[model samples]
Target: MIYLRRMDYTVIVYHLLFHLLLLTLGFSPAFCFFSSIKNTFKWGVQSVGNAVCSGVNCCDFHLNDNVEENLTKLLKDKLFGQHIAASLLVEALSSHRTHKSQKALGIGLHGWTGTGKNYVSEMIAESLYKQGMRSPLVHVFAGRASFPDGDEVKKYRKDLLTWIRGNVSDCGHTLFIFDECDKWPVGLIDVIKPFLDYHSVIEGVDYRNAIFLFLTNTGGSAIGQRMLDLHEEGVIRDKLKFEDFHDEISLSLFNEEGGFFKSDIIRGDGIDFHIPFLPLEERHVRKCAERQFELKGYSNPTGRMIEDVLKNMLYGPTSNPIFSMTGCKRVHSLVLSVIARLKLEL
Candidate 1:
């Protein structure tokens, strides 16, 4: 009789284990060992995801969502040239980030090298997230550095899509910047077309709530020509308006011979604006020198040093008029060098 009882107990234990296996595989997660544990784990993960997508607990970093206050902060000090572009940037970016809006904000920043294209991009991040390039929402991909020759482009496309989809799913308010896009692999831009599409939200990834900025010197020469044309006609450089170069820039960007030739990002109506960053002249370089000097902890300014800095920089166009080829990009280093020399001379 004791042997019979032992056999019965063994049967009971087997049934219990079988029941648990069914419960876990059929009703709960197949990966979990226990049914109750799986239910609770899945629920917790789903709840967190929901909170993030709904705009709660999305940013680990602090961000100022105010528009006008942010605008004031953007224009208060620093950033010398491109006032019109700055105003447009504040107006557009403020609305895009703060208000509930649809479609990704596609901004094409075009200009000569060192002409504040990258600077403006930095300022945009600073105003929005206060971390500038360090923002969790901002992703910068440079052409040569990112898409080097090889089968890397293939892998990069997969990673890029995954990153965008995953992040946009987590938080709809994401920002992507592609710098020096002129040198991007020939077929790479084509792969990004769908993500830039209006209202393209896949697998709970709402890409419409994101922002995309493309910076390049692809149309710099054309832009220079138009500015030179305006100057020749007696239009003050400061008076150069968006209307003067907007259409020309758009046309140039989409031209077949251009670096971004036939790019859907340029051709498509999805792009919100083509912001032209004008070339910096001597006066603008001086303004940049002043800012750079102040940044170096200089309480006073020197005229001789600033002029020499300007003279050291190379100019271009080699025609009726010329402008700073290096823009204010080299001014900071030049400013510091001149200051050190002057102090030693004194």
Candidate 2:
């Protein structure tokens, strides 16, 4: 009985002494060192819901491969008829990344519907984030999806500023994608003006480490006319050049010819590269069909299915019969539908 009581007392005393020791060391460097270690490890594991930069090594992050070989390959192999946009995208991303002071890219992709504007944006994001479009640092904003109403639009400006400031301050590397910017309310894009400024920081937040991509049909009419004229002049769609779209598209945005044509971003010259996505020709549509079949691993029926998709899709400019109304946008579903019918017959 005496031995048992003595053992219990000793254990209690040891614990009390150990706790007192810890309390005494709390004000010392050792306590700070251990506390920092715990915090660094905790933050390294937690995905950080919003932006938590409260650790010794909180800013340490994986270095992403800047767009170079991967982006060029993605553009040439995946996309069909956007030579100029693809080239300009590579150039802008590469050049902008190297700029020590400005270190940001503002790309404006414009063309008729289904001209691979969104697809090109996706490719760029995919290259940056190994996990693809779902990257935490990639902020995609479509006016309809992000700001559904007037109140939401009003709230967006403040929310957007907070988001960019928080994320950029934490790591200084981020990608901002604004899809369908033409649909955004008159001054919604202007909210981003302060961040896009060439100056180092707006509110102590360095935004130079960011990339901004705007996708819209803002210059559709101009693109369609240029292609129509080229078709009439015996210029094959494949041979079309960037010089063909040098002015009409972006110039229209600043001109205020239409209500939708007024974008302060363009007027302020905030956009760095304005790459025009030309209308896709029938051959481009066929190429898209072929790629879709390749993705699905279907053989033999590929040629016939390609012909069927092309036949069903309507083309504009009855005189020329050139551009696909939906570009390759409808090609994937159309190909899938044809495959489904074929299987039923089989």
Candidate 3:
């Protein structure tokens, strides 16, 4: 009887161990873990492919096929010029100084927010960098928080100098794009004095080929108001009068808290040197739709229909040309998302 009991106990212990092993194998997260690894591998492969493409025939970057020839030439010339500075911060920067080398070219591009100011700045920076300007080509951003010295005026100057030092290259030819220029404290205009003072670097090197582009949205608010007023006066016909573009934005410089600010402004240099918001015309949009369909390995609403949908979203009822820099971006992103989805569907 004792031997039989011992045999039963041994059988029960073996059965329990076998069941535990089976449960471990069946419920293990090995499948999930492997799936994550596979996804990561695929992402890495795609990233590599994008980098190798180098802006040639890549819809991912959304580069314009009708890149302006004159703009390209102008950018190349500016990159090669000696001692260039550009901005609308102050006219003083552009005025002739007794000293020659200290002087640089100052250029200002002003429009209300949503006008694609930073977009243009990025294009310019990218163009220069591609032409071999140097690293750290575009500095981040700075503002009032950098100054806690005095009341509004003192603080503004301090903040501006701080921004200049932090952003301006003490070494190489650095092109600084001060985006959202209107938000910059009014007192900081004095800080631009040094870059404008074409005499000596307060330290050592003279800023040769270093141009500062000040993009602002506060050019003339009254003009926008007039457009609206005129429309109300029965001068304009359409319900959507071109008067919504006018509004004055005085962003507070007294920052107890720190964060990024954005704006919107409509942007085009007339028809002469215009950088159209949309890269492609109607025909190009159609072609893109077809290509998208082919890539998805199918076609529906055809490619042309898909193009019309995207076009309508970008420049139709949903579209507004007059916006601060920030506003423009929101629209751009929304349009792109819609197009991407439509591409998949087609």
Residue 66 of model 1: what lDDT?
64
Per-residue accuracy of model 3 over 45-151 as CA lDDT, tens digit each: 65556454433223224222322343354434421110111121112222322225444444444343443455456655554444322234445343333333335
What does the lDDT come to for candidate 1?
0.73
* Candidate 2 per-residue lDDT over residues 68-180, each given as its tens digit: 77899999899988888888888888787665747467888888888898888888988876545776677788857777665565687788878877877766667889888
- Write the number of the candidate with greater TM-score, choosing between 1 and 3: 1
RMSD of 2: 11.1
List lDDT for all candidates, in order: 0.73, 0.75, 0.40
Candidate 2 vs candidate 3: which has greater lDDT? 2
Candidate 2, 298: how far from true, in Å? 1.2
The TM-score of candidate 2 is: 0.79
lDDT of 3: 0.40
Q: Please provide TM-scores, in order, for all candidate models, with all chains considered together.
A: 0.78, 0.79, 0.42
Give the poorly placed runs of model 3, Cα more than 4 Å off: 1-102, 131-134, 142-156, 159-163, 166-169, 220-328, 339-346
Tell me, by TM-score, which candidate is best.
Answer: 2
Sorted by TM-score, highest first, which candidate order results? 2, 1, 3
List all candidate RMSDs to the true structure. Answer: 14.2, 11.1, 18.3
